[model samples]
Target chain A: MDKIEEKELWPEEKSLMKAEISRRKFITSATLAALGLAMTPYATLAAAPSNKPVNFASFVEINTTINGQNMKMKLDPRTSLLDLLREQLGLTGSKKGCNQGACGACTVHMGKDRINSCLTLAAQIDGKEVTTIEGIGSETEFHPIQVAFMEHDGYQCGYCTPGQIMSAIKVLEEDHAGSDAEIREWMSGNICRCGAYKGIVEAVKSVRDETYDKKLIKRTQQKVS
Target chain B: MNPFQYSKAKSADAAINGYMEHDNTAYLAGGTNLVDRIRRDVTHPDYLIDVSELPFSKIEKIEGGLRLGAMASNSDTADDENVKNDYPIVSEAILLGATDQLRNKATNGGNLMQRTRCSYYMSPHFACNKREPGSGCDAIDGHNRILSVLGTSEKCIASYPSDMCTALAALDAVVQIQTPNGGKRSLPLVDFRRLPGDSPEIDTNLKEGELITSIDLPESSKAFAKASHYLKVRDRHSYAFALVSVAAALVMENNMIKDARMALGSVAAKPWRDQEAEAMFIGKKPSRELFEKIAEKTMEGAKGYGENDFKIELGKRAIVKAFMKVAGLS
Candidate 1:
């Protein structure tokens, strides 16, 4: 892991870190006040502020189940789910393309529904289940969707592959991959700047067809039994 | 992003009080738009009141129609059996917007409260009157290919960018709001959003600390229930804002139009509905020619900005297309 030394901090970086510390201190005092402690601690801290200007906001502790693992983390109220996933949890499989909802590169599963992690607040996921691309499959074994994408050459740059796969899995789960047109419309949110949409669509269709055939085989076997 | 105080409100009263106690406080639900705006530094609320956990997430069938809770996810509402079977236009409109991912996170009230996607309004680099009142609007002469043409004022010309709201306007839905004083009031969807006028900063008629509770859709005739349609023409097939969209519902009796409701989007500050044009269809036989005439009447006084002049024609065709679809002509 890369670490930044205190002496190597840039002028702006140092100021930002100072502000962050002060903000954390203020949050600690505010939390105590909310717990029936007197507000004197918060008032004194606000009045005794140091050289660096600090805009203190409350920090929220979120208990979320990510990748089937229950974890609790204190997050700034403004932290987005994408930042919490990549920066704090070190799960960087979900790439941030456009932080705005315009691009779906940061797609992940919240329960059964896929959501743009960049647009979702980290605090909003309290007590919710989050599934990132890393959780979709293991390094030793690939999910069928990942294997299908590899077999069909579904990506070029691979920057958006994680989001594409996440969205595709949800597409099949939602029963929206019934036809080529349906696949295209359902997967339209995850944009591939490489213009590998033709192969992407082919991969999704192949998975859908394979899954359907397997279902048929299982049904026939059940009937025979 | 600017740091702001955050609190999770346990009840509706707590949410309202949290907002009213602060000068610049915003209710947080879904956070799809509010978070994005905060990241861009376009909106800087001093405090955030989390209302996502409030008991406003149900979609129930009322005595007359459907009542959609404010916090109900757009995907759930669109996929509801009742909405899909009875108000399919609303379902179609909701599905046409954003994506499956956005629909899952976006709540009904959040969708209604979403700000315009106009480049000038969203980007802080440009002067946007809607962002900073009296600062001046750069889109008035700047790049306005996606701005509104109807109901635009010189002060601002941002288009309302919600497909669900467009359908709600055509459906004559009512917005239920919880006043700060613990009172409740209802406003029709059409009257819920306001025109740009001089104060473009004010997007809706919602007052400070007034929380949107639910939206109610009134019962309509079977003809309207069966013959409603939403048509959106955009730069792409999906995941794009509408260049011009239309939501039309009609009731036909004996080959004559008995009633009609039409509302347009991306052409005004709010859903642009021409009641006069809708009234013109009553007692008249539905035809392409009549639809064209009605479209023309609806586009009257629609002055477009330089780049968006094509919307005048595109909006007309979209209205006609929607009408044709509802009439089962095409």
Candidate 2:
């Protein structure tokens, strides 16, 4: 429906295709009309494909806030937001055990909503607000959840501590996860391979029961709403 | 894994043309499934066409049901207001798939295209015909406890891993594709993923130049809104893939079945939507025997070898459990 699809192709008869033109050259990629990548050949293996312009996932500039910190970065579309923060932005607090969404090791808050940073692409983070483990509070002023995790001994090997913290923050955002069993069910995604689950549960319960503040609730409510 | 070229497609034709130009061009959206695989060397696309910027990111109520852009992330779709009220089954299925973080980044199209997580498939060193055709299928003779007994062959035994897809298939979605002719086509959700026939390499019937643009779904059913749920059983709690899963929607008129739809995942070559099983419940009441019979009908063609024989029973149990919930007996 755009200018590209609307463009009329100058006639190139399909009948003119030479039968003996080697199977390697006959892959006949669908890029007969593209403008980004096929224009030039890639390495030797795919050299037989058409000369139409092809494109790969490109780098883009994203201006966003992470953990109340506003920052800008030029990131490859393929670079997950979790990697961008943990690897590129010097935010080493986030962990990465199961990168494919299974283990919730790389959890972060985005626009007040907690999300698994590992599955999120940096480009998708543009114009949104993100909060990493480093963003929660300064050493002089620890976030209540952070203090609770520390006090509750909410970690053993500590690989999943950051993600556990993020999940606990988002637990209040969800309306369904209630009761100790529900909390356990909701927090189940953030696995502690070290079997530090009891500590993680205690850390979450401590925040929910005693230290949950109106200010934190307000921000989370605004996000959930 | 390798340093590949990247491009953000402005049009569907541009994406298709990009694919035509390179033998290894793959459309990158969400990258939840593809990126991890690439890191493990499961997929080796030399050129990645960025389609996230294309119009395929929108999730709106298009026809009677919702029209989800191919790039519409699972978290967004699960969180959409219309989806919550109208297509709750879709939302529920997505929610049951992964955690909030993963759902936020997984696209509907990419979710369906996710490769099976058969241990053999992920271990690139193992023999997996799905990863490398004719490499020799190790799962057939190996530990394939969670594999597809339905629509499976000796060539492959991996079960589809996306929990969201199980519900989408039950809802009768349509996948929109723009082909090389600049003409658009749609494949039914049930027929999108090719069965593990002789060639496990071909996952979908998609032609060489086709790019999935969106998924057009049918009208949201009242049954789905009133009584629908997805149940998955796995070794670990939240983060692991399903060992046996069920996506079911049922409506009852005075305790008699008025309508039913059921799909199974994590124990099939694809998300298995069986109308035959649904037929057993069309006019029947939910009873233990009736539920067992319905489950049996679903596995009418199940054929398993090696470690997956137990899945047949697990698959039946999972669907029965869903019926119990639908019947409000639980």
> lDDT (0-100) at residue A48 of candidate 2?
29
Once superposed on the true structure, which residue ranges of model 2 sit more than 4 Å away at CA?
Answer: A1-88, A110-129, A174-177, A210-225
Which candidate comes out best when scored by lDDT? Answer: 1
Scored by CA lDDT, what does every candidate get? 0.85, 0.74
lDDT of 1 by residue, B180-270 (tens): 8889999999998999999999999999899999999987633478789999999988889899999999888999999999999889999
Q: What is the lDDT of residue B288 in candidate 2?
A: 76
Question: Clashing pairs in model 1?
Answer: none
Candidate 1 has a TM-score of: 0.87
* Model 1, total clashes: 0
Q: Backbone collision count in every prediction?
A: 0, 26
lDDT of 2 by residue, B7-57 (tens): 667787788888898878888877777777776666777778767767888
Evaluating just chain A, the predictions reach TM-scores of: 0.69, 0.65
CAPRI docking class of candidate 1: acceptable
Please give the lDDT score at residue B326 for candidate 2.
74
Q: Which stretches of candidate 1 lie above 4 Å from their native place?
A: A1-57, A211-225, B221-223
